[model samples]
Target: MNVLVLMLTVLNCLSKASERTFPRIVPSQLQFLEYTNLTVTCEGFFNDMIQWRVLRKDEKRNRRTSCNKNTDAFGACHIEALYPSDSGEYWCESDDKRRSERVQVTVTVTDVILESPVRPVTVGDHVTLRCIKRKKLKPSTKFDFYKDGVHVNTSSTGEMILHNISLSDQGLYKCNVSEKGFTKENLLQVKAVLLELPDRPVLEGENVTLFCRDKMAASNYTTFFYKDDEMIGNSSSGKLTLNKVFKTDEGVYKCQTSEDRESEEQWLAVRGGNSFSTSDVSGVTHFNMFYLSGLIALPVLLFVLVFIYKKYKGPPVTNEEDEAKYTALTKRDTSLYHELKPPNSTC
Candidate 1:
């Protein structure tokens, strides 16, 4: 019986001690996006009463608003429509105001006007959008970026980076001032680009080579070869060499290269390895015929020589005596007695 009475007395003392202890609470990192919500709470203090208080660390102003130290032993501190100046250290203290610890409260103030990410960004390019404030604020606070009403990224710094920008990136971008409740918006413009080839190109075969050469001497500029609207080959130096070509190689080929814009294309009308030769056919054909006639005439030339010799030599001219004998027999020596007798004598 005496042991039971002692145990009951000890239990009552322990309960009273538990009720008097108050829980501790602290606020972590704070942010300001034009408007900020700050909540500070106390926990674990069952019996001890908790009171919410706000104090401007720079100006030293104070407030007590936690349940007015009523039924709730733990409490919270809240400030509405927080401003840059409203930012300070706050605390949840015991109702007696004797015990306290600091709760960090942050409020962000954004620049009234922001200038960032100048317009006309090409698709697949990198871009940077910056926000500049009219007035300077505390430097320790970080900045956050948003796109098309969505959170994109944050910088523990004042600048945010966007890489490999795309068409989807085209939207209103705003910067949130994490420390001072400031926000600024800017418009984005993204352009779409296409790959293209040159207009007209003429290629002569064998003795010539075609290139997707640019009128300019730009380096690292590439030329893409196209046939019937589809790309088939790519070159850095722009030259496309065709060696030992065939009829299948004949067709239209175009090349596009890079400049500030695209370079003048070297469009090539590839001839079927022999088209160049065919173009001047009339003259070549005439010369070939002349050469063939000369070659055929070589063997017939000997027969022509033999005919000329037979006509010119032997029996064609007779000496005067034979001529006179024929004349005497046929005409009976009409010229004179001397002509008749002149088988022996020629005059």
Candidate 2:
């Protein structure tokens, strides 16, 4: 029985590692105009339970029904009338929660513009930025580039390339193109890469170590570790150790080499042993509930106060002397009219 169990474990690991991959979304542009239709087709074997998911920020939006109608033949889905809230990373997943590679979509309720990729890119990777012109792409000569409102480069092509992007290359990049004697500018952002973190969960009071790796791993460079954007530790051995982890230590952790090429930031969850529960209801955290309730109720409370004031106190008295005169005149007129009126007559 032990031999059979060992064989099964090995087989499971191999099966997981050799799992078949899926093709990306065709006509793959990340950004789109609001109310536009997006048709995406999966290019791989599809299971009956296969569905699509959207990942925005740190949260994932799961679909209730199958995105594809005829999965046994072709796997495709159409999104009609996209909104700004629809912008996120989209991917296909099986019933068992096995997910395929993600494709990002950003729907904007603005003019046609260029957009950057929604996916995180690593250092030494080629990043491509695209210019979107409504439903289709258009060609234009004399393209000007700007970084944070500072002019950088000019190209005859609409697309701009950042070959082997580094830390300094990360910023808000804008492209200006003259179309029909009118110049339109669109913005895109680039970010630095973060380092890989520990996969295993660190229990409270336990020690944790972080490592930084880059493309030039062979070269020797000092490593710096940051927690919640604050520098916490640094080491020459390319590794930093945090002794006695606590719930306070749980935050976004990242590292960077001396070359300034940073790694991807990852959340470090310190669970067990008096740690706070991370389980949330429908992806809504306690903090989010409080924040949303406060935001929604604040304006309503202010509106109620304003309505009560207007109903009871009426409008503001901009000219106090004039208001007083008006009040006095109204009272005097009412008294004189009452005095001049005839008394109640009894028949």
Number of the top TM-score candidate = 2
- What tens digits encode model 1's per-residue C-alpha lDDT throughout 1-347? 34344444433333432121122223233334345455455432222222433332543345433422343544554544456665555544554553333434445554433345332556667776655454455564566788887888877656776688766777877777755454545667665433232221223444334555443335677776665457777778666656654534543345566553332212232333333232344454566567778878977998899888998876555698788888778666555666567577765
TM-scores of the models, in the order given: 0.25, 0.41
Identify the runs in model 2 with alpha carbons over 4 angstroms from their true place: 1-32, 37-111, 136-157, 180-193, 200-208, 213-222, 229-232, 242-249, 256-264, 270-347
- Worst lDDT run of 10 residues, candidate 2, spans 12-21
Candidate 2: lDDT over CA atoms? 0.59
- TM-score of candidate 1 on Cα atoms, chains taken together: 0.25
- CA shift of 172, model 1, Å: 0.9
Please give the CA lDDT of all the candidate structures. 0.49, 0.59
Cα RMSD of predicted structure 1: 41.3
As for candidate 2, its clashing pairs are: 193-262, 193-263, 194-263, 194-264, 195-263, 195-264
